[model samples]
Target: MNSLIYRALVELIQGLAVLMVIAYVMTRIPSFGDLLNRRLSLTHRVILGLVFGLMSIFGTLSSVDIFGGLANFRDLGPAIAGLLAGPVAGGMAGLIGGAHRYSLGGLTAEPCSVATFLAGLIGGFFYLCKKGRPIRIREVTAVMAGITLLHVLVITPLMLGLSNEIRQILKAVLLPMLLVNCAGVALFFFILQNLHRERLNEAEKHRIDSELRIAREIQMGMLPAPSRTGDPRYAVHAVLKPAKEVGGDLYHFFVRDENRICLAVGDVAGKGISASLHMAITQKLLKALAQSGEEPAGLLERLNRELCDGNETMTFVTLLVAFIDLRSGEAVLGNGGHNPPYWIRRGDVSRLVLEPGLALGIREQAVYTNQRLCLKPGDTLFLYTDGVTEAMNAHKELFGDDRLKTALLRVREKDPEAICRGIMEDLAHFVGQSEPSDDITMLVLRLESKEDAAAGAADGC
Candidate 1:
């Protein structure tokens, strides 16, 4: 009796390991996992039922003998199959496993097989009423314990003829079987719940990543195309590098009329998708106001009013708008809590001082003023967000105003594109191995006399 009990325990443990492997295969394979869904077709459910039934048959064949009957952990696969896949699958698994047990031709075969079938039926009834709610461990354990008790009682009548042997088998094996099956079912579900949750998390992450990629492309497309302009007097170039998958920095330029070109550089506070959305709103408002031919100061004031009306987030934007007269080298610029822009003339670089005001969306009736600057032939104007000066290095040192001024001096007299490229290279070289913490936006515009422009065109400059 002691040896038989030990063998039954060994079988239970081995069957548990096999169940784990089967669970892994079901979870790792997409098609098999789908078979466990409540909405599966009848045909697919039957197939899954057959698979679990075979698993139970394997368990029964691997079981140990006790008196006139087998002591097997065959109850686990069918009961769990029914709980997971509903009544039909569970019932089918029970039938298959019970038939296999009966084939061994034991005195208790009929009663054992009946108990197995009833176990599947009971489990299936529990699953039917679950209504997609999670099956708790305590609930499963209770149900499995009831089934084991029923199994023990059902075989008692068949063992009436062999009373003394029945007493020994029941005393030795019944309690162990009851404990093993109950614990096994609970353990299987605990593992299944964890694996299911992990797969869901991974799927959510992949979905968000894909959406962000599409959003990045859409945000980039919103920027004005630098190649669309054919204005001779204005040579313009701009670059924006986001610190994250998406950013708040924006640069837009458009030729308003034959002799006027409007451009704006903006930095929306905060970062990532929220900031990017506000940046888009700012650009749209600015473009609409720009079309009205408002001067820099007027345009900035109007934009500020619009942004403040529904500003629930309390977010603000630092903006610089400049309208240049292509024919006269005259530029009217406005500043809204933005960084000072640099004016590069001939081979010298200097900062263009402007009257500062509160950032947009900060005050309801904030006023702004325009500053005037005259661009000389072959003169380039550089504009940037605070990200350029505040960029950090490996040593936590900032790429300050001094470094930016010096870099511009090196690229003086170059075309707008070359000037922008040189500044970026210098910034990159200075900040090696340091991750960017903000969005970097830069724009360079060069004005030239009609004769110099014509000459440069002839020389491919």
Candidate 2:
């Protein structure tokens, strides 16, 4: 009797391994989710029922010897169907398995058949209780335990006619069979629940992706046109690549008054929706404040105070702003903890001198000072954020100032668009397969006459 029970436990384990694989595959089917979550068409519902019934039929065929009679996890198919889906699929699974058991024709056959058929109803009662929600581990365990008891204690004795000899056989077989079937059913349910969770996680991932796309759109739209033209004194072009979480990097060139156009480049301290909002506010405030005819230093002084006034978050930004007179080459610029621009005079690249002040909003008392420059026709000022110098490679190497200066040499005698794109391409090649750590932004503003513009255009400038 001990040897037979041991063999029976091994066989039941082998059968349940196959059933768990089948249950995993079944739950992954798109139609199966519709059966659980939405109203299925009659044709789909029947097809699903037939598949569950087939699972029950397979269970009956894999029966093992327990004492003198055969035992199998045949009822688990319909019971799981009722617990996961609803009554119809459960009842169908029960009918199919029970009919197969009855055809085998033993003294215990009628009782086992009745119990198998009722297992589906028992599971269906819980399905109605949960109302299609995923069943909890404790609840599923309790339900399986109750179904096992009904088969062993209530239905079998009534059918076989209670006797001391028959009761002794049942007492011997009941414990092992109950434990084995409940374990098998629990393993199967575990696989199906994982599939349900994965589906929900995939849905949430798509939702975040959709919202990020929209936020990026709104951020880009806030900038002044990438190529701006007011008078023939200067032309502006810029390029920007935001990090995965959009960062605050901004460049704007707009007519400040009849004789001048103001240009500024700024980078906020952080990334994501918060930084994007800060970038938008900075651009709007600059455009409004520039209209007051403030010079670069006055604008920075006032902008810093405004940003610091209500800022409980203590977020700050690096900025360089310049006001250029269209009729003359004279320009006045100011810096607030920003990188100094590269002054390109007739194809020569050199760093422009600008003393740094504290970054805006870092301290309300921070003062920005004016730097003066005279631009000859064909001279350009290239402005960029530190993302250029600090960009990392796969080997964790920085694309430092020396490499940037070398790349800048190649951009000379080129137009603003070419200058921006060429450096970006070189940066991408150097940083191959490395995730970007910060936002990159570049702007090219050149003092040009009609004759200079035509000559620059001829050389692919």
Candidate 3:
């Protein structure tokens, strides 16, 4: 073996072995294990990603110069991020590491950057393949081994377009890098597996479940009760099903100024507690803004600004708002990165044409425009979250928009209550025995005739 290869391999192995020992000790510490066992908040999760990114930076800065090219563990941070935080955070760590590597110009800079990014991305892809469960050792080993292969096959070869330089670089660093990364990942995960196991306390689990149940109750309580709206000139029926104990889907209705009825539905960027909290904030801001009697477009603008203000988590919500004239049934609708609603007009279903605004909290300066339409008696306006159309079945199929349109046409002649129930029934049947993949929400609005209102009253709509 060449002296350079021998030195690189020995140094890398020593460094990685020390790192593994330190990590193992940290996990063995009760305080550190306690911290690890706690459920991470959004801020903590973001910090975790940043920590991994920092690790990537460290890997680059501490690289060993072998002849001309540097042998580095730069991709390790991103790969670990992918294993722990899923795709987005893993990809972010890769970008951070890649950006730093690119800043330091070298023959291998571009390929190393690409290799680092893929390491994180592919690691995350494997993490998601397990569907939110703890990944098996085989998968982790496979990811680590794959990273080693990527470094040798792609990163080393692409260091120089010339074969002589590429071969020299590969001979020096390829095997060392592979050996350290694969062994390091296995040892690190061996420590982490214990931490994951320590979090399985039944009492702690029950406490979390109880808290989530209370939160779900409070969230459900915040939704509008159509029966309490005081005006029955129009009929509105809505449904919401969260994929978790708490979800980020929103649907609300309120009688504004005794004439206009504001109907709205929204979906936050993600699900679970963080998203649920974000939805609550959006709901409060929305209700407060809508009470000022603003038009749908203007209301969204104000809501967007409010959401963007001091938003550290960078969460976003896609909303659709409609203000309907109680007497004339004239409706003005505005959208922000949400699924465009379908207008069911007696036997015909049409997707409404509206300016698709950006989701709120994305940017403070987003513009919004309104689309106007009239709802005649017997015509129903249907609004929903993506969960309805993207609902999955046991066979890994989505209940797509085509199915939604077809299903709507079949029940177009029914009342708002019946229409809501019928579509939900179809969705449930289509998704039988399969886990819900997301938060689902649906709202139906109809301009009720006098006879229709009387029937609605009797049916407790």
**lDDT of the candidates, in the order given:** 0.82, 0.81, 0.82
In model 3, the worst 10-residue window by lDDT is 452-461
Q: After superposition, how far is residue 381 of candidate 1 from its true place, in Å?
A: 2.1
Name the runs in model 3 displaced over 4 angstroms: 1-200, 226-230, 451-461
Worst 10 residues of 2 by lDDT: 452-461
Residue 84 displacement in candidate 1 (angstroms): 3.1
Where model 1 places Cα greater than 4 Å from the true spot, the runs are: 1-18, 37-43, 57-72, 99-110, 125-142, 155-168, 171-176, 190-218, 241-245, 291-294, 349-356, 365-367, 387-414, 418-436, 452-461
Predicted candidate 1 versus true structure: per-residue lDDT over 15-79, tens digit per residue: 66777777676677877655554477789768868987987787677666777666666777788
Q: Each prediction's TM-score against the native? A: 0.78, 0.91, 0.55
lDDT of model 2 at residue 39?
A: 64
Per-residue lDDT for 297-365 in model 2, tens only?
989999999999989999998999988775556679999999999988866799987889889987998
Candidate 2: deviation at residue 26, Å?
2.8
lDDT tens digits by residue: candidate 3, 322-390: 988765667889998888899977678999878899999989999999888867756678999999999
Residue 263 lDDT, candidate 3, scale 0-100: 86
